[model samples]
Target chain A: MKKKRALALLLTTVMGLGLLTGCGGSGSSSESADSKDAEEGKTLSMMCIGTTADAYMEGYQSIIDSFNENNEFGVTVDAEFVSNSDYKTKLTTLMASDSEPDIIFTWELGYLQTFVDGGKIVDLTPYLEEDTAWKDSFNDGMLDQLTYDGKVYGIPTQECVGTMYYNKAIFEENGVAVPTTYEEYRQVCDTLVANGVTPVALASTPDDAWLVSQYIQQLANGIGGYEYFESLKDGTGKWNDDTMVQAAKLFQEEVEAGYYEDGFTGVSGTEAEALFQSGQTAMYYNGSWETSNLDNSEYCEVSEDVSCFTMPAVDAENAYISMGSVDSSYAVSTNCKNVDAAVGLLKYWTNAENASMLLYDYGRMPSTKVELDQSKLSSLCIDVIARFEEQKSLTPWFDRVDTNIGNEFNNCGVSISNGEDPQGIYDGLQEYAQSQS
Target chain B: MKSVFGNKKSIAVFVLPAFIVYAIFCLFPIGYNIYMSFFDTNLMEKSTFVGLNNYIQLAKDATFIKSLKNNILMVIGSLIAHMPLAMFFANAIFKKIKGAAFFQTVFFLPSVICGVAVGLTWTFIYNGNYGLLNAFLGAIGLENLQQVWLSNKNLALFCIIIVVMWQFVGYHMIIQLAAMRNIDSSYYEAASIDGATGWQQFVNITLPMIKPILKIDAVLIITGSLKYFDLIAVMTGGGPNHATEVMSTYMYYQGFNILKYGYSSAIGVVLLLLCAGSVVLSNKVFKTDDTQM
Candidate 1:
């Protein structure tokens, strides 16, 4: 009887401890370790976007390593790298829990606005004003996207515009040239299909729905120009506008006509890119950040033959309008123990030497004004830079405009790809937008 | 020892630790979740109290309705697959069929592999262009039927349901088989002696003997299907325009993707209630007296 009572006590205690430890696993351990480290000195923690598959990861790593070795503050920075696809979910969860890193890789505009509104991100306008030289180093209007209500919350690292990357060898083999008009683009796709070639490598999976939506938005830009996008952003536009429906219909036609590879809707972004890199498809449309992947011999089988052109306009008058915005940006989280160290690290990352290294080595276009050294750039990078210079106005992705409406728009894009009517989809989106307001 | 055991203080001491842990980890979080469901919150900002507004909006939300329907379909699909089909396999093995041991291991293999791995494997099999399914169809001169399985919104859910069914049939079979084995051998021997054939013996001996275990297994299948998440998340991600969205995945999307924590918590509440309701309904339907078991 005594043994039975003792056994019951032991079992209860063990189960209780198991539950407590499981529940507290993410808390007590990290808190004790972090406090211990802080007592010694400052250790700035950062979370940035980089994955093994990204060609620029090496450049990103080298920059971080150099900063860790040479920073004058004697502060050692610990950084965690999350892949781009999972970064948003990870960051939001961390922010909600008040466990976000000191510095975070963030998208500009609406993506950062939520955190700014929540008071989870530190306002960097005062810091910028104090360092006039550092503030002026950035290009004109680059900081505007990261600014909300006259307060800057992030530092821009790179700039990107969408470009149509094509395999020159495939084009030569198929006897097709870069189309300058929407009609000519359709002709080229038709010709490619007639010759048994997949015209575009596109991904329409849920995670990569943004990629599909960007293409449709690009098409809409051709039909309605920069003003259409601006109107949509400012809430004066209806998603069910004629130009938007037309673009969706046109995209649907392409999908049905086999302009994209079969089973493209199920393909992931990386897989779609690989299809183009392996020379299975004639062309691929994505952001200029893909310049590195297309130019890197290790990633692309036909790297030498890969070249880019601005996507042809649906209306020739709106030729230079494009989809693009500030690319990589880093913001200081309000939870940081040392805000100055985090800012110092951002400055170090955006310095001219590092920016140039990233530009020349990884094909990342710096947001700062750096003198172009054409001789060192890959041909694909040079073409992308030229295309960037030609854009009349660059509209950022819809998701970066407003996460709520933009996410719905992405889902609508997938539905459009799956043969749903554009009119009903857009009507629902308009209703959702109105309801939110 | 008896005095110690009999003491109320000792009893409280023995029970307090576990009770405290459960209250903190499980009970408190549930209470907090219910509280948060009435507010519009991102959890980072000051949450605004909306008082049943989230639940009201959920009622009119098409995506939520679609997801709820999908979850119901999943429950029905799992019930059909895990019960009758698993019983057939279990009875076959229990009767000492040829290579029963080998067949059991083979059938049980998929359930042990991780859900993510199972999802990924099935994705490859369903891929349209170079997938095994399409290739097999082509070889058999049925190329017209080779559609993109997961990309087709109408068919995506059924494909996922088939995979779920395939993955867990053996798990339920093993449970039922164990219950069948627990029956006295003399019952089957007596049935055979009474001029009962193999089928007769099975219906008389195995069927009634596994009733209690079957009831438990039914509850497991129903609740497990209602909360199914990882497979859908890893495979379709509730896409082809939300055709494959289940309750759990939609809850995730609302909570994390769009930062509508209040709305998501409402969905979570609905899910919890439905699961509890199902357990109660199943208990009543499968009610067997303790003496009978």
Candidate 2:
């Protein structure tokens, strides 16, 4: 009996120690092994926002492949792509648990600020100061958006702007010109409706509420210009301000006039894009990131006829103001095994070779300056880039600005499109926004 | 043998392994959750102890209140379908009517399939543009009645509830059917000899015998519906302005999407309390002096 008790006690102690070590940080036992692996560099992990279905996923992968082929760090790169809808939540949870990938795809402004404030992201300003050539590769304001408290934390890889993509064949058939003013835009929609064509292809499901909200925000940009957006960003603007209410009212009027696809409230984002791509609708409004989808001949039947223009200003004095921002930024996590190796990968990702490849093949506009190859560029891609250049001001998505208020703003768009009273919705949103702060 | 079985020390030795596993996996997490609910933490920084602030905020939150109401409606919907409707089907099968075995398999089929698959199948069926439901309505010349099935705020939850009703009614039927088969045949023979009708026999002999099982089944249906997550999560995602936001989905949204771990913990605690309250209420409703129960 004494021998049995001793065996049992010993077994339990071993089991308890096993459990304790398993729950503890993995760094302790692996410390020596980690240093040895670091000498050979390591297998670096990168998380990007795109599924296999996205056209740009190919472009992102080729960049990784090329970097692996000729990298100074002896590290091999492995990539993980997450679907757009789930990426934000997945990244945050990973950051909080201290298990995020070495490098992560991020949005600009307040989206990346959450992790910076939590100290899960590396401050890359000193590194940028060391590599001025690489720092200067990005556009002027692109790096500024990812900077916080005078420190840079992420690198912008591309630029995107919301543009109105129209099917030229449908417009020509309807005998309508590209609208340069809000009234002319309304007239264009009326003309398409009279010709028995759905005027605008739009989606309003909660999953794709941001698409609708962006369209509404674009209208507000046209109405109130860059000053209004600055006011909101600086905490001086209200959710129920006249400019916002007016924009929503115009959207509601368009709905009543049947200037949008019928039964559009139920349509999803991809489904709405398909309507324009297949020529079922005259126009689609979305970000420049969709140029690849529009440029594909196999998927888009109206590929040849697709060209874009900025949505005409509601108030002509505010012309050229648009909804856009630095897009597809990358940041090095504090959990990274080697910040230099990760930064090297980021530099490779945004280099002229990869940038031109991404732009020419997949239509992802480079954040840095590069000579245009007209022969390789799609007409739609060129048009979108030109329009992006002409913008007087670019207001990023509200959700990218602040997750809470931006989400509520998206909900407001869904409610408005569903025929809810805009004034009441915005009023409620303002109350919610206040409560959140 | 008697010495080992009767001794408290030996009993503890036998039960210790299982108890330890249960404590680590279940009890510890539940305790941690309840503790976390008292703080205001996003799980990255040092959490601030806010005392009952999360619970108080949940009470005042319109979205949370909407989710609570949605959960209650789901429970009610499940009870209506899983209790009487399921019982009625079980009776038909118990009567040994023609094709009873075939009908049993058909009714039990959906519950065997996974919830996510069921949700996706129903979403395709409910698709606004090219869905079967819309196409069928159009075929029957009821074009005027055709509308978006899952996107309409007023109708989306009802549509999902109807799918839920369709999917689980059969599983509950099988449970009741098993209890029915356990009943002795002699009671019914005596009832027939006494000139009792079929309905009379069912109401007295069959029902009284199965009352205990029915009580347990009611608790199963109620708790299951209250904690339902997969179907709603895969379907609307508590959307069209959170028209179908049940407590489970709302809790997931708060915890994962919004990064409010404390608030979601409070939601979890509320869900637990609701489940416990329903179990007690059900026991009271089914109270009996019969020793067999």
Q: For every candidate structure, what is the RMSD over all alpha carbons to the true structure, in angstroms? A: 3.8, 6.4
**Top candidate, metric lDDT:** 1
Instruction: List where candidate 1 sits over 4 angstroms from the true fold.
Output: A1-35, A38-41, B1-12, B197-205
Q: Which digits, one per residue and each the tens of the lDDT, describe model 1 over residues B69-109?
A: 99999999999899999999888888779999999998889
Model 1, span A1-437: residue lDDT tens: 45335534644554454345333311211335566555444787788888887889898889888888988877888888898778888887777777778899999989899999999999999889999898999988999999999999999999999999999999999999999888999999999999999999999988899989999999999999999999999999999999999999999999888999987887889999999999999999999999878889898899999998899889999998999999899999888877888889889888899999999988998999888888988888888899999999999999998998899899888888888999998998888888888
lDDT of 2 by residue, A1-437 (tens): 45335534644554464344322211111223344554455877789988655788988998899888888887877789998888987776676566777799999888888778878899999989999998888878889999999999999999999999999999999999999999999999999999899999999887888988998999999888898988887778888888999999999999999988878888988889898889999999999988988888876889999999999999999988888899999999887878888999998888898899999988898999888889988898889888987998889999999876787799779888988888888898888877877
Going through the candidates in order, what is chain B's TM-score?
Answer: 0.94, 0.96
True contacts kept of 2: 0.42
User: Where does candidate 2 stray beyond 4 Å?
Assistant: A1-41, B1-4, B7-10
The model with the greatest TM-score is: 1
Which window of ten consecutive residues has the lowest lDDT sum in model 2 chain A?
Answer: A22-31
DockQ in order: 0.43, 0.25
True lDDT of residue A384, candidate 1 = 89
